[model samples]
Target: MDLLRRRAEAVPRGVATAAPIFADRADNAELHDVEGRRFVDFAGGIAVLNVGHRHPRVIAAVADQMARFTHTAFQVVAYEPYVALAERLNGLAPFSGPAKTIFLTTGAEAVENAVKVARAATGRSAVIAFTGGFHGRTAMTSALTGKVYPYKAAFGPMPPEIYHVPFPAPALGVTVEDSLRALAFLFAADVPANRVAAIIIEPVQGEGGFHVAPFALLRELRALCDRHGILLIADEVQSGFARTGRMFGIEHSGVEPDLVTVAKSLAGGFPLSGLIGRAEIMDRVEPGGLGGTYGGSPIACAAALAVLDVIEEEGLIARADAIGERLSARIADYAASNAMAPIANLRGLGAMVGFDILDAAREAPDGLRARQVCARALNEGLILLNCGVQGETIRILVPLTASDAIIDEGLDMLAAALAE
Candidate 1:
């Protein structure tokens, strides 16, 4: 209670936390508050802890790096860990041919740098994004994001030449054809195809509610970009690493993008983001054109290296698939039951799962009741989050490193919350 009061006074209201509990410690898929109460972490720190909280390997890597040196600033004094991580990411790039990578501190930085690189490569100023898609909270990303109310509200006048088309979410009554037609209309009426520099999309929409991009739409986008000379950028900020049963979500579509923005789970829990792109496009930016003071922090690089090792050694990609199957089966059972709230539309790729609370009529989204379920689940000692344009989604971002028992326990809490 005192901590809550202190938080209310010290923090700005704009930076909202999903739960009021203050973390004392966390391990794997569980967190303990200062009050010594435990909570099953279904949120995974908003998809940043795929390897789980404070994994021994990640901690050791950071500690080792610290013992060597904390920071000389990669830009000022180059570090081996940064270069090694970049090389590792480049080799793991989803696209064919030679690839390159540049590290940053946040998903937003990777996305913004992607746009800059795209513009430099294509010599065009306009960029395209999809409705209901979330890139980031930065001014440029906010303009790119499709949602209004919170992300873009009262923030304008936004930067110029950032346009959005409807994302094909059938549940939301926006079909793939509808999305394609809107893009056609956008080209004819709003911005010409030739003037567009890039079309950025999340292979699986994260903040827009775990909607997996239709492979058909991805193929069409690839063809359109090919014909128009526009770069296709896959923003894997929330869906990267092993969260989607693949190293990157775009891997599911089999439609290679020119550039990929990766973060969230990249460095386990460390603040490390990066852009992996084609060698030619990446080289478009001149020397010293791209970098940050703490862009590739040695500490974060060490952690990220350990994270990659963990993903491979732990077989997390396959584990993501197994976890997804388990989650989907359980959520489906809940949806079939009359005892639970009107929940439907359980969707996701791999372990990145989400379902929506609907009205009694089973039609429109029930944001209020969804909020209620999240609150109830929190009271039940499970941390959950809601997304989608209407805040009607219950997203499950459990760590891949989580044990089956932990996942089942979290799901059981979810069932109780739904019953309430």
Candidate 2:
């Protein structure tokens, strides 16, 4: 309590915190608070730990690299680990022909760089994003984001030439046709399709809500970009790294993008991100055009390598499927119950599940109810997160490494919160 009070005095309100408890230590799917309360972790550090907390492989890899050496600025004094990691991502990225990578330190940096790369390659200044899409917090990405309150409120004036179209969500009353038409309108009204550099989207939006974009929309957008020579940039920052039951979220669509911005769970908790794209497009920028000093920390590179090994060895991609099944089952049960009735929208891909909490008759969203459920879940020893433009959706991004027993226990706690 004293620490929280101290935090209130020390930290600004703009730096938000979801839970009141202060973390002391954490394991795979569990977190211990400063007061010795244990909470089942369903947040996964906001999708930054798909492999779980402190995996032995990730720990050992970071330790090994730290013992050897840390930062040498890859551009200044090149290192093999940096090159090795980029080579691995290059090979894994879903782009058709040859692909290349440039590392950054955060998802925002990666998003900004992806746009920069697209503009440089296409010689166009305009970019298109979607409603309810979340790219990053930087000035450029802020303009790309569709949400106004909270993230964008009081932060403008944002960078120019960024237009937003609707992201398809039938539950939200925005359909694929609506989004496509909006894109067409954007081209006609806002910017010429020929001058639009890129269209960035999340396969499953994270902060805006866990709304999955239909595969048909991806295919349509791909053909549209082909017609206009615009680049399609997938923002896989929160949905990447096997969180959506695939190596990359965009894989679910099977549509190749010109550029992809990735981060979040990339380095198991270490700060690392990348802008990966087609080789020719990526090479458009000359040497010294893109390089951040702390972009790809040697330690982070080592940890990322270990993360890949752990994902392959543990079969986390399949694990994500199993986890999603269990969570969906539990959510279905909760919705069917008389008390938790009319909870509209049970949707997501893989384990990235989220459902809206709606008022009686299921007509109006109930953000207050969502907040109550989260507070009760925290009190009952589970960490839950609420998202959506209206803050009425509860999204689960649990670690894929969590055991079935832990997942069930967390779900049970969540149900109890709903029951309360």
Give lDDT tens digits, candidate 2, residues 15-68.
Answer: 888999999999989999999999999999999999999999999999999999
Model 1 stretches with alpha carbons more than 4 Å out: none
Candidate 2 pairs with clashing backbones: none
Query: Candidate 1 on 211-301: residue-level lDDT in tens?
Result: 9999999999999999999999999999999999999999998999999999899898889999999999999999999999889889999
Clashing pairs in 1: none
User: Against the true structure, what is each candidate's TM-score?
Assistant: 0.99, 0.98
Model 1, 25: alpha-carbon shift in Å? 0.3
Model 2 worst lDDT run, 10 consecutive residues: 335-344
